[model samples]
Target: MLSFSRTRSPGRNTSPLAGGMDYLEPKRKSNVLGRLILIVSLTALCITMLKNAPSFTSPTSFSRSQEGVTHVLVTGGAGYIGSHAALRLLKDSYRVTIVDNLSRGNLGAVKVLQGLFPEAGRLQFIYADLGDAKAVILHIPKILLYEVDKIFSENAFDAVMHFAAVAYVGESTLDPLKYYHNITSNTLVVLEAVARHKVKKFIYSSTCATYGEPDKMPIVEVTPQVPINPYGKAKKMAEDMILDFSKNSDMAVMILRYFNVIGSDPEGRLGEAPKPELREHGRISGACFDAARGVIPGLQVKGTDYKTGDGTCVRDYIDVTDLVDAHVKALEKAKPRNVGIYNVGTGKGRSVKEFVEACKKATGVDIQVDFLPRRPGDYAEVYSDPAKILRDLNWSARFTNLQESLEVAWKWQKSHPHGYASS
Candidate 1:
């Protein structure tokens, strides 16, 4: 209107379109630089995520950082059998991660293992309860919270060794729900995690109780699983779940139905340390040690009128060492999409009277034995054939001598009279 833009300076654009272009050039360049900076930042973030993320391509696929090292997750690793199994895994140079709620497990056993395998990356422990169907949060340092899924997501576990369960037969009869939840429900949780994470190998720590009171002498793998008590029934249900899941998955399953597990670590590092309150419903080995140590007035034989040799219940006493060995062998021989059900025992039965005598010989104490009536859910006799495990996994019980097994355990008990407290 005023003709103020009529004169064109030497460095100024005379055309309106050219002037608009000149004004937008700096803005366009700034926008382009901003986009480039954002792209570079996003690229760095993606690279960082890829570096930290777990490699979950296949069942056997592990991160390049952990190449050639098989990582095993041992549940209930603070308990008797689980602790021993973890010790064996660590000794074999395999990376191990132990998860235990410590409900019936002793943290001392895990501590002992940590002491033995003090090297970094050799062993780690996480306190977690598998009974929780929801997110089982693990309270670990650096990591504020870790659900069961998070555990599977973060760690590339090649296999899972499930040993977590409420195993007291008498207690299971009294509180059936506890057994169902702890054994059956908890096993489902672990199985779900294993399946979801595509873990290849699975070694289940089952019990011979699942066989119930079989009419046969040495129960085999094909023997009917007619569980009498809740403990056995829950374990059987868990076995069914695992078998059913393995049908469609590439998981290599090994269900080890263990008989009477006895003894402790042969090197005196770990042993059975049942809680004082649980001693009433604990194993015969624990009771024998308690009686020898004068913790209990005398060892009360639960049943002495069964139709066995000594008029007492008969059981196959398998050493803890031998049992763990069988587990390792089973893990080694597992095949993808194949399930192996094995009965782990000595293929020999020992009565309460015989066991008491062996305990006395081991402890050098004439422990007073009070004969009592048969408790509820008590079996007359239960043993394992172990033929299938021997044939397939090439595993057989080496610690067959009952007294020797008890002696090795007794030495630990005498040294640590108060179990882990004596440490």
Candidate 2:
């Protein structure tokens, strides 16, 4: 009996059966406390995760009131083509937000647009550089801060029209890294913002230079993209990224491979206003206008030894009006999860010599032409078929007459001798 049972002490269970139960009680209580602590920790973790989670719902889908009204974000909207495109979008009753760094673009163009569409929500202009990965806080008597991500986050954009880039071929050849950073890297930044915000429609302003010197004439959409210059190569790289991204997304994308862009807003409110330094590597139209205005002594035709008609480089020139029209059609016809690639030209090629003659007639000036040898990265000839765009979007170039297009542009040049600076 003495070995089997121990004497009971105060506040202790000495019996063998009772002792076992008593020993397990503290452990059971400890297990219950541990479970409560674990449950509390788990609940706190769940709450934090829920608080920090990103919303998958599209910003555009937040309101049924905005069903039919489409708000578009136009990058580089202060430049020539971009400004014209913004004007067209505004005229079509679509809300437009124009973002530009004013690097190659002009603040005067933005002012002209603001004057035209002074109605508050019809148009908004944001000064920003897409290449900068961080927030750009610009102070111009007024503190303005913005970034690509912030732009998409604040605005419920239905479509994005990306037209920002350093587009000079010669410049691109000299500074390949600048072209890559501006064209390719900046495009990736904008695309990332577009994807994060779940934007549905995208219109990329591409270049026919992406085709390099194709083996065939009148480049179709399916032509092999064998870009030669840094400009073309960078653009092609951006196109590949867009194509790959579209493959896995439901975004509607339209890549318009522009051959040559000329002319301006026919209303004389907007025009091509390249900086004085860019005249050498700027558009042929700008050079022609400069020579006509006596800003330059003569038009220096860079390439005149190519194996083409007139021994000059040939290109297809499309009017800004028709080009903007094509963009609108692409925007309207865009379908989810579909990509449309179109050669946006008049389906005809014009030699540089022929362009000079047309410019002479348009400006009423005997433009002295100095036919120089072929320049670096010069293509023999490049034009577009444009049949695919017509068949798909029911759009074709109406401003086919090069002389008439030049005349319209000349009128604006004559009036704005100093471009927007005249205003």
Q: Which candidate number maximizes TM-score?
A: 1
Q: lDDT tens string, model 2, 1-423?
A: 456755655555556667365444566779999999999999999988876665433333322227578989899999999999999998998888889999899999999988998885778888888875332333231112235677777788899999998899988888899999889988988898899889999999999999999998979999999998999999999999999999999999999999899988878899999988888899999999999999999999887778898888999999999999999999999999999999999999999989999999999999998877777887899999999999999999999899999999999898888879998
**Which residue pairs does candidate 1 place in steric collision?**
none
Give the TM-scores of the predictions, in the order they appear: 0.83, 0.82
Model 1 CA deviation exceeding 4 Å by range? 1-65, 133-146
Per-residue CA lDDT of candidate 1, range 188-274, in tens?
A: 878888888789899998989888888888899888889899999999999999999988999899999999999988899998889
CA lDDT, every model vs. true structure: 0.87, 0.88
- Once superposed on the true structure, which residue ranges of model 2 sit more than 4 Å away at CA? 1-65, 133-146
Local lDDT at 392 for model 1: 91
How does candidate 2 fare on TM-score?
Answer: 0.82
Q: Count clashing residue pairs per candidate.
A: 0, 0
